[model samples]
Target chain A: MLDQLIYLFRRVFRNIRQSPVLCSAAVGTVAVALTILAFFSLIVINIQSLAAHWSEEIQIVAYLEREPSPARLKQWRDGIEAMPEVAAVRYVNQQEALRRFKSRLGSDSDLLEGFGAEILPASLEISLREQYRNRESAETVVGRLRQNPELAEFNYGQDWLERFEAFLELLRFGAVVLGFFLLFAALFIVANTIKLTLYARRDELEIMALVGATPWFIKVPFLLEGALQGALGAFLALGGSLALFQFFLRQGLVALLSVTGGDQIVFLDWQQQLLLIGTGILLGLVGSVLSLRKFVRI
Target chain B: MIHLYNVCKNYQKDAASALHNLNFKIAKGDFVYITGPSGAGKSTLLKLLYCAEKPSRGQILVNGKNITRMGSSHIPQLRRHTGIVFQDFKLLDNRTLFENVAFPLEVQGKKRFEISNKVYQALKHVGLHGKLQKYPLQLSGGEQQRVAIARALVVDPLILLADEPTGNLDLEVTLEIIELFKKANARGTTVLLATHDQEMIRRFPRRVIALENGQLVNDSAP
Candidate 1:
């Protein structure tokens, strides 16, 4: 077995050394496809993370009649926050609301002069926990708030909420679909390119078979070469994706789309980076296997 | 010893049989000739012996083991005990003569030193040991054939199967190769030479098997 291993290694090296062009062509196509996959995988991870954070920050506001009794407000607050899904609740008086609004606008006093501070009605601002941050959960809380006698009206950003829900669903669905196409493209590209290279050396393989080489003697080296190609291609893909991401950020490519801020355009974290490397390696190995399938005789 | 018991091989169209009920046997340490014209099933017979193609019916045995149902894995083992020299020479275009001759011993897991020694000895036996580093294309027709013979003999196989081993050689070179086959048989390696060289056969004949239209019509001692 040891001697066979040595001989197989020598044979693989000789083939590659003799046919450098063919080897590189196989390896190159695999790398290109893997890089595209790694890039999108990074996008999916960060989008998922940001979406989770968005759910936490999302909430609804329930405004009440002027100067509700402290006891009634307390009762309403307890009822709202006591629900199974509510995360937190806070009350803001109209005066406090007006003061906060004015502070935000900063000297745009003409619009406010026509209306008194009363225009800014106090409301109970309710925040949901991560689990209950979708439209149904928000609506459930609103329904409960409307039943309270002291509350005059309740409003949540319905358009924004629906859009958010749709966008999140779209990202997840798009990522999956994109991932499948990218993965297929990766495998197909690499497999065929490697096939072309292997086909060129069909004579060499036929000669090997004639010399009484056992099944393993022919398979192991090609498998090893495929593995090596995958590892190298995977590494190259990781680097390529990172470079592309940096370029995207510098060019502010996401700004042309619907996004919050540059801060939210998150880079790939540790988990994401690990996933990319794993993916790259997988593409590399799978591509080579597909290619070598027809090349190596049983 | 190799024995063909009514061996018959057939393909789709051209003939009902490439080799029809061919019965013969070549004993160990024997040198014999299979002399026939082209398309006379001489090549087909050699192909069957090496397990390259299966005999359509009847049993064929090598060293007392039947090869009609032998698995591909066993073909190499059977082949390890036998060597074949093709008319094309079948040397790797990029490999040197040394690598070509050393291939069989290497396949047998012989150590580097043993392989080098065996290959050198085989090459010397053919008187072309000095051209060890040259490629196949760099050598003349006769030299390339010698290299192939050296490769076949390096493992010291029990049987030597030569298919037109000297089809392209001139009179002088053909005599040299015939001498090589005789010497190999003298060393207890049975040789089966397939050829149409009537002049060579008349000069050095022990036994001859003549085939015409897939029938073995003659096997007479000279």
Candidate 2:
């Protein structure tokens, strides 16, 4: 078994060496296909991270009708915080609200100089838990909070949040569809490339079969060739994706898309990177199998 | 031993049979010749023996096993113990003589050292051991045929089938190639050589099985 493996490896390398142009073309085709996939995946990954970041910062503000007694404030805070959907609840007094607004205005703080603390309503800032940060969950928590007579209005940017949620769903659906299409296309191109390679070496394969080579013996080398091409292509694709990602970052394209911050725009994580390469390998193997199914009988 | 019982082969549904119903048997260690004109099923007969082409009817038994109905997966197993040489040499032109000879043994999954040793011996047996690094195209026609013979005999197969192996060679080279087959036959490998070269057949006397129009016309064996 060990000898067979050794011989198989030798044959695979020898094949690659003898037909460097064809092998390179195969590898190049795989790399191009996978690079497109990796680039799209990087976009999806960054967008997902940005969405999670925005979701993490989702806060629902409940404006109090009148200044609550200290006891009542404590009750409201504790009650909201006790809810499973709520991560935390904090009471912001009129003075603190004005101070936050002034700070946010930065160099334009003078524009709010005439405004008094009473102009700003005292409110409860309700931050939802990670799982409850979506539009539906936030609305559910809002509906429950509306039962309190002391709370006059709730502001969680409902219109835009709903739109953002819809847009995210659409984006997610598009990504899935596009990802699968791209994968299928990649597999097809790889299969054809390997098929061409197979045709080029059909004579050699026939000779191998004639020499009493078992089906596995003849098929394994080509399969390994595909796998090696896949692996190399994956590496090339990742490198290309990384370079493209860095280019996008330098061009501020990712930063422009980022809601949290420019720095939050990042490449695929190691796990996702590994998954992309694994997909490449799988594509190559499947492609080889597809071509071999028709071309090789022995 | 090989046995054929009413074997027939047709290339297509409507085409005439390449080989008609025929029966014969050869004991182990027997060297036989399949002599026939072109389209006389000489190649087809050899092909059937190696399980390349399935028989349309009847049974073929190699060493007491019915190979006529053998599964495609088991064909390689039968072929491992059978070596076949072709008129075209079928050598990998890009590969060296050593690599060509080592191919069958490699298919057998022999160890690297064993492959190297056996390849050397096979090439040496063919009188081309000194040119292990030479490619098939680099060698003369006779030399390339010798490489093919070395590759065939390298596995030390129980049955050796040569189909017009010397069809491209001159008389002198054909005789040299015949001598190599004779040596292999002497070593107890059953040899089935397909040819129509009457001069070569006359020079090296062997049991001849003659065919015409896909039918066996004569068998010199008693």
User: How large is the interface RMSD of candidate 1?
Assistant: 2.2
Please write out the lDDT profile of model 2 over residues A140-166, one tens digit for every residue.
989999999889999988898888778
Candidate 1 per-residue lDDT over residues A120-174, each given as its tens digit: 7888898888788878988888887777766888777778878877887898899
- Candidate achieving the largest TM-score: 2
Q: Could you tell me the lDDT of residue A118 within candidate 1?
A: 83
Recovered native contacts, candidate 2: 0.62
Task: Tell me the chain A TM-score of model 1.
Answer: 0.84
Assess chain B of each prediction and give its TM-score: 0.97, 0.98
TM-score, each model?
0.87, 0.90
TM-score of model 2 vs. true structure: 0.90
Chain A accuracy as TM-score for every candidate: 0.84, 0.88
Q: Give residue A19's error in model 1 in angstroms.
A: 0.4
